[model samples]
Target: MPTILLIEDEAALGMIVKDSLEMRGFTVQYAEDGEEGLRLFRAALPDIVVADVMMPRLDGFSLAERIRAENQTVPIIFLTARSQTADVVRGFELGGNDYLKKPFSMDELIVRIKALLGRQPAAPEAPAGPLPIGRYRFDYPKQRLHLDSHAADLSNREAELLKRLYDQRNQVLERTVVLRELWGDDSFFNGRSLDVFITRLRRHVKDDPQVQIINIRGIGYKLVV
Candidate 1:
């Protein structure tokens, strides 16, 4: 069974989550604060780390940072009530593999955990030529977007999302479709994550005025070139 280190300050929620995961056949190492979480993490390395952003000792971001410094491969998921785009981006920057907003369903959490666990290390492959998008060239294999003289490296998720958008460029990439395909469900928390990614993609292509990822409000997005 894959071991999970769960760091949550709220006693009730912690127990509930711990019980739920244990019921699903996972070995859970539960901690009520970041300090305890870190101790547990060091003592018994876990397959994955699920931590809340706000905690008594060390916050989730700090925990992730420390973990990343020691082990770069373990997946870290942040649980936070804060929905600010900056907060979400910060979590990713701190090496968090995923973010789950508060009030999230147990089912959604389980799906995300399973998805992360299911990922296999990709093998090396030849780099494919760049695909043109307005004035930008997207090198999908390298996960890089280049303009005239600048290049921006994209996360794996970002590259996948951009490719999906490019595939449906000039047409609406239905919200539900993208959510289900990329996140395994159309849960509200996953939708929030998608919005953050969309915002990041827009920033990536912002240098090219001709490239636009228009939000279809309540529907999805359209990449107009």
Candidate 2:
């Protein structure tokens, strides 16, 4: 059974969600506002977070930004009524793993939670050494990419994306496959996030002309080294 930190302003809705999750054998830590959610989050970290987009003291986006600053591995799922595309994109940008619109079914939420939890990478064993990538040396353990005298720190997602590309160098890494594996789905928003990471990885290895991560059009990406 996993622990969930649920932050919602509406007391009734929060209680319903909490009760529902508890019935499914999940430990739910319910909070009426973002500030208290953050406090509980710091006190005892949960396996996953389900938070409403709007809150009284601290908004969901702000809370997610803060959480990402501390722990990048925990899964975060945002529940919101805002239907704007920009808001959805902003949620993804702020490190939300998934976004569910208001009036969403508990079954869908539970499925998403289970999918995200199942996809979480297990702790890796000690690495042999920094892996070579053209002129860059990627230290996956430390999430650092070094080139010459300069070193670029990569986020957890960035490191994972780069590692996958490097592992499949010279081959087409299917877009849908990557999306499903990394993001849990091939949704448009997750595709955009993947593009952002690709752009970042390109920037990191730009100093070396011999290494390139090229888009395969509608297919995927190919890392040429």
Best by TM-score: 2
C-alpha TM-score for every candidate: 0.62, 0.77
The residue ranges of model 2 lying beyond 4 angstroms of the native Cα positions read 118-131, 135-160, 200-211
* Candidate 1 TM-score to native: 0.62
lDDT of 1 by residue, 164-190 (tens): 888889999999987776677797766
Where model 1 places Cα greater than 4 Å from the true spot, the runs are: 1-49, 61-76, 80-97, 101-110, 114-127
Instruction: Evaluate residue 4 in candidate 2 and report its C-alpha lDDT on the 0 to 100 scale.
Output: 97
lDDT of 1: 0.84
For model 2, state the Cα shift of residue 125 in Å: 11
RMSD of each: 5.7, 3.6
Q: How far out, in Å, is residue 190 in model 1?
A: 2.2
